[model samples]
Target: MTAHRFRSLLGGLALACAAALPAAAQNFPDRPIRLIVPFGPGGGTDLIARIVAERAGAALGQQMVVENRPGGGATVGIVALVQSRPDGYTLAVCPPICATAQSLYNPPPFNAERDLAPVTSPAELPLVLVVPRSLNVTDARGLLAAARVRQGGLSFASPGAGSSGHLAAEVFHRASGTQMVHVPYRSGAAALTDIVAGRVDFYFDTVASALAQIRAGEVVALGVTGTARVPQLPDVPTMGEAGVQGFDFPSPRLRVVAPAGTPAAILARLNAAFTTALADPALQARIQDAGGKAAGGTAEETRAELNEEAGRFGRLIREIGITAE
Candidate 1:
């Protein structure tokens, strides 16, 4: 072929390749996506994951399969996600434990900031400080006073060491200057069982998980850990309002993340689907019913927030000397 003809052929091939690249990216998630929930089923995180997955999957024109992997302080599923192929097929809806994993575990199995690509945070739930009605503590101040005077200190229940509840308890200890014995349980249900029986003195549990018990009068809610009071418990006061000043606790959020090294195009696509899903009024209402607020933002926002949380939690964990049990 003539040189001119050859050059024309090369240009045609380049255009075809360029066209194919975008087509491939757009065709992403042609198959069902695997969504891992790092906690057990029926929990707030799992509920949020399932709801978000269903809606986002509908938007993506693909189904998302949610798998529960509950262990290792909610890091087992995260490790599985990080080890998966970074092809955007595998993702995980992780809790605060995702960011805290770095500080909570020694020689961490996976670096969240380094190994996971943030998609979008679907929902956020604040911790509620609940005690059995028999405790006779109507508010945080009362609870603190009671804790200070009680012998052996008041005991607090957490799902597990290094969990969000555990971290919140530690922060509360520092802010309130009251030492509480830590009693870690295999699951929140198990812990609540003891709390209801008045076996455990207190627990900082998710509003979703504790709402039923609170409504049933099995537990009395003293204060919410978040800056604002939750709608489900408008009568409840925030920790700060309850006289616990300087209590800076980050509410537990459900973040959608994929294995690091996933293509930016794929990440953007996933974010768009979730953002769309989170914006739906029906979906938002469902999230609210579950005791959480729908959170939707750009992928960059998610990454930045995760990084900040990692740094903050790492510093706090080190300062508090928290260790996994």
Candidate 2:
């Protein structure tokens, strides 16, 4: 074909594809949608995923199957997600780890900004700084004092390396000028169990994972990592309120994301379905009961939030020299 003729043909194909997008989106999700949970079952991310998946699936008139693919600092599943077809059929539940992975790894695995597209963050759960009851540290100051006086310093546990809890504790350590040994566990539940048994000195765990233990007095609440206190722990103080100066960490958010280059129309549909699911009073109540607040907004807002978080955590990880290991 002549040059001009070939150029005309390409333009026509582009126009045709553009015209077909809306129709494809209108009939989007005709089959079941796969939602990848980047953690083991029963953890905070998994819990929120199941709660939102059921309602979102119902809204989309399809089943949102939850698939657990936990490993590699929660990046294994996300890498799989990034490599999948960007047809809106597969999605993933993104935690703070999603934003931290690139910065935490050498050479990086997948760039979150380049590989994933945000749909909406369904919920935000703050981390609670807790200590074993055996320690008798009632507040942040007490914990600091204990850490300073202790022979080997205190030990802190996280669900895994590069997790929000791990980074939060690192931030806390720097802000408070205290030293704490890092203990990485397979899951938050395992870390919490060690805390209760006095095997671990302290942990910065999501309120969702630690609420039951906190309520049962198995562990003592020091302060939350957010600017505001959690309703579930009404009497507990925020890190700033508890005397860790200017210590406010964005609560770990649970987000819905698709592989990059997914159709914008399809993303809009997914966002709407999740927004509708999050608006349900029953779902909100369930989220609150699980120690998270329901979050819903436009896809742009979700993207902006994730980007800002990635920047913040990226700077922190670089400064502290954190690695996935």
Candidate 3:
């Protein structure tokens, strides 16, 4: 064929494929969708993912399969998500790890902002500041006073150096004008164990993880890290309300995301399905039961929130000089 003819043929094919893109998106999820949970099964993220998957799948007329790909500080699943084809078949329940992974890793394996597209946030978890029952501190003010007197002798336990709990404690320290030694552990459960044993001074743990302990009198709830009091712990004062001004730490948000470059139509469909699931009164109640608030918003809102959180945690992680193991 002549060169001009060949070029014209290529252009025709390109136009045909572009026309088919929306048609394909309209019939998205002809099969089961893979939903990656970056954390191990049974954790709050996984539980929430399962709940949303069940509801969203029904709404989408497909099954949303929950696949646990836990590792690398929740990066393993995210990397898988980023590498997946941007056809909306593969999505992930992006946790706070998405915001902290870049700062935690010396060189991040995946750039969350560049590699992933936010769909919608399904829920937000509030962190509670708890101390061992043996501690004499009654409120956040007393805790700050004790820290001041201890003069770096006081220590706080966290799941790891760059975990949400760790960063929350750092934010609290900056707000309270106090210092505390950081005690890192392999897992939140391990950190909580030490806190209950009085080996660690305090912990800013998720309300889900620490609620049982607090109810059982194993740990004393000093304050919560949220703008307002959590319903489950209504009596617990917020970090700001407890006297730590400008002390709203980042919460563990449950967001859905797809690979970057995914068609806008596909993304919109996915967001609508998930948001509809999130809006279900039963789903909201289930999320509340699981120690999170059902939060569904536009993809743009989710993206903006993620960007803000990434910046906030990045600064705190750098200031604290925390490096992942």
Candidate 4:
């Protein structure tokens, strides 16, 4: 072939490849995207899920429907997600430790860390340390002092084994050097029952649940788990402010992920949509109003946060001698 003809053909081929690039990036979400939430409705996780689904769906020009598959401390929905097609249409709204559930919770056949790849973090909400109002404990220090007087016999309740509440309680336990008996329950309602009845000594719960109970005089939030006191629970001090030094928040954070082997392009696309949508005033206000702190970051941040929480929790559990039961 002539040199001129060959050069012309190469230029035309390059132009054709450039034209297809847009299709490759934009072909996503030709239909609805199913958002799998690993918890029941109305809790902090549910609220975040709905916010992301609604906002991202609007941004992506597709529908993002949230599906609750709550069971086994979010393991059930995750397992279902792992088994889903990795076409970017099926994504999961997972808590930070959804990746570490394998190490923290009872043996599920699959390793979540190996099975999932992060898309983005929608928001994070720190739970509060609280006790039944009848317990007359108004602060973590007071509770610790009372537990110290009780000699490690004060009982506490958590939603389930290895849940964020359970792990955060461990963090509180380590920081306060207090040993309180854990009373495990299938759900927060069940745990709250015993707590309000004064059968359990203390517990930490997400704002969506704990704040309501705190205002009703059913439980008293000793303090918030974050660095600053939440606006809704303004009267309550932070965990550190409540006299537990070095004890930061035990966060109830949500991250999005897909089954491993999903393409990086898809992850990047999803992350862009999430990052953009989360910054919108309506979305941010809705999330904050629902007792969550929206966070937008790269996929690496989500992965690192999950890993850090797992490592932190694993040590706390072992140090506290928390055995899986």
List the candidates' TM-scores in order. 0.93, 0.96, 0.94, 0.88
Candidate 3 accuracy as lDDT: 0.87
- Candidate 2 structure quality by residue, lDDT tens digits, 1-325: 9999999999999999999999999999899999999888988778888999999999999999999999877888898899999999999998888788878887788898899999999999889999999998888899989989988888999988788999989888888777779999987888999999999988999998899899999999989877788899999999998988757687888888999999999999999999899889999999999888898888899999989999999998989888887
lDDT tens per residue, model 1, 1-325: 9999999999999999777766667999799999999888998888878999999999999999999998887878899998899988999987888778788778888888789899998898889999998898889889889988998789999999878888888888887787789999989989999999999989999998998899999999999987898988999988988889888896778789999988888898999899899989999999888888888888899988898888888898888788776
Residue 229 of model 2: what lDDT? 87
Clashing residue pairs in candidate 1, if any? Answer: none
Clashes of each: 0, 0, 0, 1
Position 255, candidate 3: lDDT: 89
lDDT of 4 by residue, 1-325 (tens): 9999999999999999778756766898689999998888877778778887888888889989999998866777888889998878899988744745656655643575688898888887878877877777767777878878886567878987777778777677767776667788888778877888888888788886666677788878887876777777778888888888777655667889998877777788899999889989888888777777888789998888888777776676666666545
Candidate 3, superposed: residue stretches over 4 Å from native: none
Scanning candidate 3 in windows of ten residues, the lowest lDDT window is 243-252
Superior candidate under lDDT, 1 versus 4: 1
Model 4: worst 10 consecutive residues (lDDT sum): 100-109
On lDDT, the leading prediction is 2
Clashing pairs for predicted structure model 4, backbone only:
225-249
Model 2, runs deviating above 4 Å:
1-5
Residue 248 C-alpha lDDT in model 4: 62
Question: What would you estimate as the lDDT of candidate 4?
Answer: 0.79
